[model samples]
Target: MQQVVIIGAGMGGLAAALRLQAHGFDVTVLEKQPRPGGRSSVIEECGFRVDTGPTILVMKDAFEDTYRAIGENLNERVEFVRLDPNYRIYYHDDTHLDLYSDPAKLAEEVERVAPGSGAQLARFMADSAAKYALGMAFVERNYTQITDLANPVALRRLLQTRAYQNLYRQVARAFGGSDKLAKAFSFHSMFLGLSPFEALAMYSLITYADLALGMWYPLGGIYRIVEDMLHLAQQMGVTVRTNAPVEQICIEAGRVRGVRLASGEEVPADIVVSNADLPYTYRHLVAPEHRRSYPDARLERMDYACSGYLLYLGVDRTYPHLQHQALYFSEDYRANLDAIFRTRTLPDAPSFHLNVPTVTDPSLAPPGHSLLYVLAPMPNLTAGIDWEAAAPVVREKLLAQLERIVDPDIREHIVWERDYRPTDFLHDFNAAHGTAFGSLSHGFFQSAYFRPHNKAPDVDGLYFVGQGTYPGIGLPMVHISSRLVTERILEEWS
Candidate 1:
């Protein structure tokens, strides 16, 4: 078997190890952190379990594909409980719009909200579904070199996908004047760190993924998926060594041979796949001469996804009316987005995503208690905001923001609380400039064929996976990225 060394035991790295191991590669996963799962990790504090990041689940088929490829079935291992109302969007005035999984019920709700909106929603769903299908196919086809996509037909199809139009414009065209409908559909773009007005219309496929595949959650928590994937990787005989930070990718001539750990120990392999942040890998892991094409000058010009300021709270009391998922939008959504993306500062009134697991799975908390993850999209550290000064203020602001939209007496009911700022993401993940979700802005130059390469430009036999590369951010896309890279590795060794 060809030896494959995967750097980083993140979701992408773990998934890649599973796929490549099945393809008969001897895989060894090296994680710098003591634990696996990367962002979807769990922390226990004061006898309360806190899941710090990545709350909701979407694109169920991706997990199914991963297991099936390994001669196993995902549903057989983990039961995915389909969430009926995918996410309940709580408006500023305390009223809500439930974005449901069932199309008929969703349309019924649409009709209730705006006359004749059901028909518009139908058309919108149909178009979004097509985009999702086409997007997946095109996204998976590797453009290892930008010139690989010079074919005119591929170019035309790419343009036709509205990779050019802004997501907000597309939503406004379909759901005009209905602010609630527009906000509900365009909200996921926040994951990409783009305001609906700035993010690509191609992201409209988020609608299809949420409504069609159905919103879901593992029985325990999002972190359970990580544990499951880790279990599967280990079962396949892949050795995952944690707290093994790689100092550099040792390149001989023009190809990658292996990596040197920070401890001065060398772990050699025939091939190396980096699940690290792409920009960080280019800057730190690889030497300066090897980075001829992917230079800091060009990288500086690229738009980075926003970082997150998160608070993981273990509440002492139950929020009976809260759902599993909710978006607490402060008034002036556009201005708030502008403050984060454009101004690169905390907004006067920021919209936050809240995950109340107790509402859906009471087992996550002690009886009559809750767990909440409050996340806000802010510009990466590139904006140069003073996080030390802002972390506490932001945390308090999020609590206040949650109070306005959800529970009025939120602080009084708090059992335990911990907050994460951009600094934490940078320090922990080596995330470039504390960027939250990696390379996700869907700007003109940031599109697929233009995003970070799966294969390193300078070093041979060095490939990339996860949020920074093609197929982009979110759990499902990263899973697909792992699949694509493993296929390439299989072909290369064969």
Candidate 2:
């Protein structure tokens, strides 16, 4: 039997473990934290369960594919509740729009905001759906070399998808050049940690995926999916351990031998896969001699996704009218974007995403209480702002904004509260520059074939899976990345 050691039991790691085990490889996953899930882990505080990262589960097909590969039905293991009017977007002008999965309903909302936009909305959805289909086939696959980008089928799809056009521009043209409608449609790019104005038009498929396929919430919170995968991994006879931080990847000559834990214990392996932060794996985990292309100097030049200020509040009361998910756009949405990605400064009126799971699952809190997960995207640690001082001031600002939007006295109901900053991501997850998402922005140069490959370029028997590698950020991407890596492993062995 071939011995395999995977570092980090994150969603990607767990998926990889299950797939590889089914392929007859003996797999063991080592996670540093006391629990699994990595960034997606649950935080149980004062009787409230909050998902530490990634609240929404977009693209259910990607998730279902994983279980289907192992001859199991995902629905039997975990139940998912589809959210209609997926998200309520609050604009600066005190108006709101509800994005629905049904095209007719969405067209109604679009026409309500901008006359004549109903037809445009339908056309945009059809175009986006086509782009999404093409992307799934040509773009999302694993890439081992630059030549992979030159495939004729992928090139044809790229042109058909208008991959050369800017996402913001594409939405503007499709929606009859309405700024309001364009912002609403294109802002989904931010979820991938990219500005819509700069992200490739190919990414507009995200909006299609969200409004067409719909947003879903797994029962017990998003962390429930993680729990399910972990349970499956252990049941499949895969060795899983927590509190085992790997200090180094043991490399012999040019191939990976295994990993050395922080406890000074060495574990031997015939294959090794890392689901840790990509830049961190290259900069800190692997020895300097083993990294040829990703030296410290070159890595410093790479652009990273912005981090965020997170607040998990368990309130004594619930907001009955609040949707399952909501985004409050700042008065100056573009300025807010500039603050985080361009200027690397704090936005005076920062936009925020608010999640109140009680709207869907009241069991997360006391019968009448609620759990609020607030996230404000900000510049990563590369900005050099002192979070220790900024946190309190920002918290007050966020509270003031929440008070105006949520209720007159929203702060009074806070019975329990906690926050996570960029520094915490750095300390806890070894995320380079405290980036909550992962390596290199999703620009043209940093996407698809241009993104970091799954297999390490300089070493044999070593691979990567997760947000930092190809297919980029988001839970669906991570799940697909795991499948891609597992297939790569199978191909290498075969």
Top candidate (lDDT): 2
Runs with alpha carbons beyond 4 Å of true place in candidate 2: 151-154
Question: Any runs in candidate 1 off by more than 4 Å, and if so which?
Answer: 145-163
Any residue pairs clashing in model 1, and if so which?
307-436
Clashing pairs in 2: none
Give lDDT tens digits, candidate 1, residues 344-428.
7778877888888777677777777788888888778888889889888888888887777667898888888888888888887
Per-candidate TM-score against the hidden true structure: 0.95, 0.97
User: Per-residue alpha-carbon lDDT of model 2 for 23-61, expressed as tens digits?
Assistant: 999999999989899888788876789898989999988
| Model 2, CA-based lDDT | 0.87
TM-score of 1: 0.95
Q: State the weakest 10-residue window (summed lDDT) of model 1.
A: 149-158
C-alpha lDDT score of every prediction, in listed order = 0.81, 0.87
Superposition error at 118 for model 1 (Å): 1.7
RMSD per model, one decimal: 1.9, 1.4
